[model samples]
Target: MGRSTLRFRRPAVTTRRLIRGLLAFAILAALGWNSVLLAAGNSMQGAKKEEGGFEGEAPTAILIEATSGAVLFEKNADELRAPSSMMKLMTAEVVFHAIKQGDIKLTDEYHVSENAWRRGGAPSGTSTMFAAIHSKVPVDDLLHGAIIQSGNDACIVLAEAMAGNERAFAEMMTKRAREIGLTRSTFANSNGLPDPGNKMTVRELAMLARHIIQTYPEFYKLFGEKEFTWNKIRQPNRNPLLNSLEGADGLKTGYTKEGGYGMVGSAVQNGVRLIVAVNGLEDPEDRANEAKKMLEWGFRNFEVRTVFAENETIGYAKVFGGNTGSVALASHEPVKVMVQKNGNDKLIARVVYNGPVRAPFEAGQKVGVVKVWRGANVAVETPVYAMDSVDRGSTLRRAFDGVTELAIALFRAGVAKL
Candidate 1:
């Protein structure tokens, strides 16, 4: 027999890595879609609540049901105003984001920069997390000082530790605030310094607070700390509500020569959670009183009704390919509707989607939507998708499906050309 040579080459490392990365990407895409379907069902869309019953509200005031991000009442919720110390909410957000990314561990020590000391201990700084220069402060202590004590010194130390300098870190805070829908906000410093350009709306501040509390529940309790010590100096929490209000868990307070008194307050009463942010007040007492009244009004007037629950199968979808012909559809979290004391109970909960999602389906793939309507108007329309996977079909099955799909496409295309 004549000698024959056949060469076989194994896949290159890059090819293997690409395949692995693509597979991982696909898996993540599926899971993310599933999460959206589960959460998107909880949509609350309505025309701006009409000039609420209450008035004389601060030039800027907002009351939102925390769990559902529903605005119960507002005068100038979206109007731009200085966030005051409420800007720290974003500072805290950046710090938390670093902690999560592992860039700065909770136990990591932060070095105190001279600029940090000046800005934090500046004669202008209302709350100072006292820190001496050339000292290594643990991450956890810095966080407590910034959150509980509203210490500027502590904030700068954290900013420097996380971003090399306070000014650079403040830019990070501004970027994150914008990403989270705080469109009206501009940050000039790590702390809420009084500058013409640095400002935010009560609505935006409330939204930021809600995001931190919800996304980082583990570290959120740090906001509720009553007292904190740094450099052996202990300071009491300035938020008076934490002591008197039931379920008055946490939040932050702010004061400045130009900004007057301002606060972003959160509370939970009777299982109902609320966030209220106020600014441009004349005094601390006024700020506290205004927040309390706003929260009380929200609790007394609005109520939450669950329209769908997570994992609760809303319907099934026809899926082509893989091991099954049909896949289940469900929300990851409960869907809720917040309404006035006596508004509309006749809400129409409906699901709509194109039939038979084609295969290569991943759990949580968005294939359709759930829309909530009150008579002729849509209360909210939440996008939804598949919550599980449907692998490629067998050769024979795929051939049959291809023929069927071709026929359907031809019919649809012909009609559209009409």
Candidate 2:
């Protein structure tokens, strides 16, 4: 055997220490993970490991029923966090509204200003549609770019075109967001570039997703498109569910150095739709996996049961000064709830209202709430409206009823003291 100058080279001791330190941090973080409470649990309670329910890695998440607006699962859903590319959904919604209002046309063309091109276009160190400066791309093409491709460049271009500048466009986005009921969210830019001012809660993001799907069904299909080609370059949609999951259709994904990975995903299975939003994930795979798990959990673990038919009386509320002693309450629409598979019939319901409601209320007046409790947690709350109109009672009757209500209150208080 020839004496070969073959020797094994070992990694530097410092490098080895750094790798070990990183691995250790990951393990400790997993072990120390502070999970939020599930249904009926104390807010400060520590994580209780359970199966067949949502116990995902994302620090914050929410799953909502698209039809009934019933929250299936939530973990820190109201905590404000960076929205990342998810903000583009709002940007697209603004454009969609403008087109719908005839303020802009799908065929209308917008100039790709140098500011948009240099900062967010292909030249910028971010996702871009590769839109050329001074090019006039149609509103429709840019919509696809911003949504399907998640191109920041397309967002900036459309923003400037719509509002003469990105700052003003962001103002419009914020205003429009509030108009659409996203009160806890704020938009600093059209494409959701890393800005401290851009913040949204997982709950509000789900609300916005549902709004887009319901309000703009015609344009919402753009989100499901797999790919878009512009400036001779093609890019696939960043939304992960559209391809991997069967009913996954449209939505957006987001990531930044500071915000980590986030997603707003929706899917429809057997006429039942679910919207899921997640944030604060360190890995993109984790975001995708968590989103899929939540949507599936929502569809699998819960089912919608109509508790009250439209115009069917759910309960009654006392009327102190009305022509009648009480008024029947009913749901204007079919009141439904998402409950555990065998648990639908076990829901405990109660009509909650202040008073004896006042007299002279209309038949359709919303007077009370029908709250359905599942275990210790409230599963759903349907607004119960007055089923029939009631005029004011006569003077003698009103005085008598008022006195009687007062007597009842005093009696209840006396009994409690015993």
Candidate 3:
């Protein structure tokens, strides 16, 4: 979101008037001084926004609050591109769910097939942990290779172990992606290797990262592991931020001739966490620096403001033909907003709903939305629910109220004409 600066100007007076109206000019200037101060403050705030909200060099990028899912910045984030190895997040997710459901165990071992060996093995000249042919690898070691080492062979082996083959496992990945609310992503393979159909938006990648972090906390630590060893060969994690940026932790990186360099990185500083996704960069250092910049911008420029506590009444909504005249409206979770810092624009919240809602509304029924605005941008929009149920009024009372409502409407219309 962007904002414009405000400027103030004083009225001009002629020489003839200045001699006769010195007192009046002084008074006018005194009155206008407050306006000047307000405009200057607005200008400073606008400058801060311009400087702090810079979108980095990545063609597609997004930064979000890990806990609240509030987007702090976005640039072409919804446009689809090849995800490369970034698709491994979903692959990890599938295995995480399978393990949680007792369908698989980390101790389970799978035989590395020749396909995985040749395509993703050492001879592939791509990233790998160099799993030997016909060797048995445990699910735990394979995950380390896939996440920390970015080993394509490890991904294929896990895919085969989970769904019998990479193609079938890719189908499961797509299905699970849809189930997890990734609408714009499609998986052509489990490893996110280059393919015509292997594409994902930056927003989708960030969302998938959030889901994995929140849903699979027990397994997410594997992504932060610095090195993993298999077959007496040790490989370092490809995620660049872990070494250079403080508080940088688990995540994965990707690169392909068709997809470009990209990374989905998450970090927590002082209990506030941010997740960033960046893609389509020519250089790995550029990708790392841009992702770090995006995350730091989010942490520095935006702050979380809790507007209302959970179940606390925000306001009352008028009711029509109900046992009561009104009902309290509130949010199920604490309403929080990611506000741009150093901005004089006050955050304004308004309850929106069809007036005089009909009776018989149950408790917790969704009535409307509490829309909070900052300048022209919507900071947050939270669902407002009825705090208490309201039953229908007596038939006689309902009839009388209906007529009264009509009379009020008619009178308001009549006043508008005046």
Candidate 4:
């Protein structure tokens, strides 16, 4: 496989001329397998402050733009740690998905088992919605209890109601998580109680939060509710951001001796939404403050910039055994990135695909992805598709392409030996 990288310094303003220049640069740069670095200019002087300097006390954290899914800043974002009750987000997602699929209804009632009552109810000495044993509860109330009250009993009841047991429900949670693009998250139980099997990364947590917000707009409102009342017991929402930050709407908070303190929070400012996930803090107050600070920092510093307009050719992908040597690549949606407004950030954009691809593909077929990096983190990545279809080449052309691939493979094998 081969890779092509185009490195350039991001300018203060992005214009049509800059994009055209980058396209011409990509055409020439794609001819070589190695990376090409183009210096547009040196860093601007007299900048008031450097970019990406905001630091938080959380050991694992990530902040991202909600609409574009652009990473603004991250620290140990991929390191898997106990997610605590933040994993309840996954629990809520599972229930939400089932409801969306029409497999269940909000009015459906579940019988609370003795296990749920004894382990997660008032006797458990943990966050509980004070559910009564042997009593039937509606799914609507359970959702409110789980999201707003952080009620372990509510999650357990929902899990049992859906999958017959918490273990099976957790398997469903992990499977559903994968289906929604959360790759590294796993669940042991519904309420994110202490368990060796529950693990998640801050980055994936942020991604999950974004997915929930986008996928279930109606159900997501439950996250922002300040308080929930069930069975005559009313409890306030655990997520402090809802009360502390302006424009803060919904999300969840978690804590345990093992996972420390963690929360997934989202807030909107001036019509721009930002999501933040922080874990492994020493104090609950620190967790709330750190999440709030990160969201504020992201909104204050980053601005979205379009990299490529919709249907505009992003680059090219080499084709094997095709009438044409390469196919033009473009994204269906406009590719956008969030960057520090005043920083002189050097951006590296690359088109990555396993190629030369075997041909006979249709137009709009996915060919590769365009990844843009700001500083050390990937600011944004989007799928690039073929702009036009390519037919199979003549027999002579196929033979030549086969020979070329063989020679290239041998050269790579030799390089590996070195």
Considering every candidate listed, which one attains the maximal TM-score?
Answer: 4
- lDDT of all predictions, in order shown? 0.74, 0.83, 0.81, 0.85
Kindly give the stretch of ten consecutive residues in candidate 3 with the minimal lDDT sum.
34-43
Candidate 2 weakest lDDT stretch, 10 residues: 35-44
Candidate 2: residue 183 Cα off by (Å): 2.5
Candidate 1 residue-wise lDDT, 191-286, digit = tens: 787777677888888889899889899988987878877677888887888887778877988877777788899999888889988888898888
Q: Residues 217-311, candidate 4: write the lDDT tens digits.
A: 99999999999888788789988988789999989899999999999999999888999999999999999989998998888877777767899
Ranking of candidates on lDDT, top first? 4, 2, 3, 1
Top-scoring candidate (lDDT) = 4
State, as a TM-score between 0 and 1, how close model 2 is to the true structure.
0.80
My TM-score estimates for the predictions, one after another, are 0.72, 0.80, 0.79, 0.86
lDDT against true structure, model 2: 0.83
Residue 149 of model 2, lDDT score? 86
| Candidate 4: segments with Cα more than 4 A from true spot | 1-52
Q: How close to the true structure is residue 343 of candidate 4, measured as C-alpha lDDT?
A: 61
Clashes of 1: 11
Better of 3 and 4 by TM-score: 4
